[model samples]
Target: MTKSQIGLRERKKAATREALSWAALRLAVERGLENVRVEDIAAAAGVSPRTYNNYFSSKAEAIVSRHCDRIRLVGEALRERPPAEPLWEALTRATLAPFDGAAEQPDPRWTAAVRLLLREPALQAELARAGADAEAGLAAAVAARTGADPGGLHPRLVAAGVLAALRAASDVWLRADPPVPLQPLLAEALRQLAAGLPEPSSS
Candidate 1:
């Protein structure tokens, strides 16, 4: 195929995927997340059920598709940071980097969809799975940058902690009434992560 043909094909595929994702999220918000069926979502996207399956294995997966790119984006951002930067600093920047280009004005509808994902049991599980993958990717990148073993304990532990901070901050942000900007929330999470989750309690 010609270069233009390839570009067109790629763009078409991306558009189709976005359509499916938007359709699924819309249905999930309109109805309950559990109430939406793959067929119904596909119909909403003007695609066949088979096509929906081709893009995503389950309804929860479809609903959270937009966030998947954010995971990889975080990983890539961390990888590109200056070598002298500490892990927490790099993680803070990487984690919130995706929202830099997003509209400063909060999209109420989109926030509602995020709230739905956080509350829905199945979608929460899917989100956790995505989070786990992101943690692993970040760990691998960190290990490579530091010349440490990717599969070793330190990287794994740090990755888990960082991912946990991210999850906790996101949960808080999702429910924030009048919703604060995500960047500050994420930075606070990193600060908490840096201070350590463990502390000496007043006896």
Candidate 2:
């Protein structure tokens, strides 16, 4: 009933959500998506199947929730960047923060699993919805920092474009024949956007 109690309750809910999501992703990676079920995920997370259903409708949603949480956190990070920092610079740093330490090339098995997950229709839908939510959150942060209207074209367009660049960069990284450090690829993606996406010259 008190403020501290309310905060603690919300924190507990968030922790439970994260645990279920983490379990789903781990199961998918270890046993493949088709082999995993909501029951399996709930057991892994030490929650009942009914509790899992309260948080996520399907296995795909549970798996994608972890990535979406990171996306949502990027918006929070952007809001905390120095107010005087250039918009693109702050945006780039916030976006890359979640992925910075994961610079090592991915294992081929993980890449294969990710590729499979990306191709799933349920996950694709979840990802699309997550992108929209992330764009809205980032646009609000941009509006606050730059004194622009969150619903206006400038904030909306910038947020949408930034997320698009993120998706493109992720796609490129997944398809890289010899896997490369994702942070550099993601940085290059944002850098290209900050530069107005200049065309490359032929060698």
Candidate 3:
């Protein structure tokens, strides 16, 4: 096949994967994560169980798999930031782009589904694994931005710090009664990170 044809084929495959994942997440949110099976997700996506397994090993994976794409978007955004921009500013802006764009927002039911994942010990582990993958992607991006070795501790540490702040911000927003804007919470998180979290006074 020609290169353009190959690109189109890959795009189609990606679209399928996204469809399956979105369906899985939606179902999990509507019901409960544990209550939703792989077969259920496959049916929801109009695919067979074999196809679902080809894309994801388990239901938990299918639910949170799109996190890698989010990381890549943030990484690309950071890469495109002006050279004079501060690291925190670039990182925060990059992190916020995906949430602000034309992409479909998660249903309100999905928000509750995420809370269920957080509460479920097994699903929580899967979520953590997905998070680790995102962090690795972010680390590579940070290494490229600062010219650090990809495997170096600095890149990993910086990536962890940034993601931790992002997670904390999300948690705070999620727990709020009316749900506050994520950007301001994220900004404060970055600010706290940049300022090195306040230290207790010495005795």
Per-candidate TM-score against the hidden true structure: 0.79, 0.88, 0.81
- Model 1 residue 44 CA deviation (Å) reads 3.5
Model 2 scores a TM of 0.88
Candidate 3 lDDT over residue span 114-186, tens digit each: 7766676766787687678878888888888888999999989888988898789777766655556767787
Best by the lDDT measure? 2
lDDT for model 1 comes to 0.79
* Predicted structure 3: lDDT: 0.77
Cα distance off (Å), candidate 2, residue 181: 2.1
Top TM-score model: 2
| Runs off by more than 4 Å, candidate 1 | 2-8, 101-117, 195-203
Q: Give the CA lDDT, 0 to 100, for residue 187 in model 2.
A: 90
lDDT tens per residue, model 2, 1-203: 99999999999999999899989988888887899988999999999999999998888888889778878888999998998899999999999997765647888777777887778788899999999999999999989999988789999988988888888888888878798878888899899988999999788
lDDT: worst 10-residue window of model 1 = 99-108
Query: Worst 10-residue stretch by lDDT in candidate 3?
Result: 101-110
Q: Write the per-residue lDDT of candidate 1 for residues 1-203, one digit (tens) a residue.
A: 99999999999988888789889888888887778899999999999999888889888888887777676677788889999998778878877887675445466677777685668788889888888888889889878777889999877887787777766776766767776676677788778778875565689
**Collision pairs in model 2:** none
- Candidate 2 residue runs with Cα over 4 Å from true position: 1-12, 101-103
Clashes of each: 0, 0, 0
Error of 3 at 23 (Å): 1.3
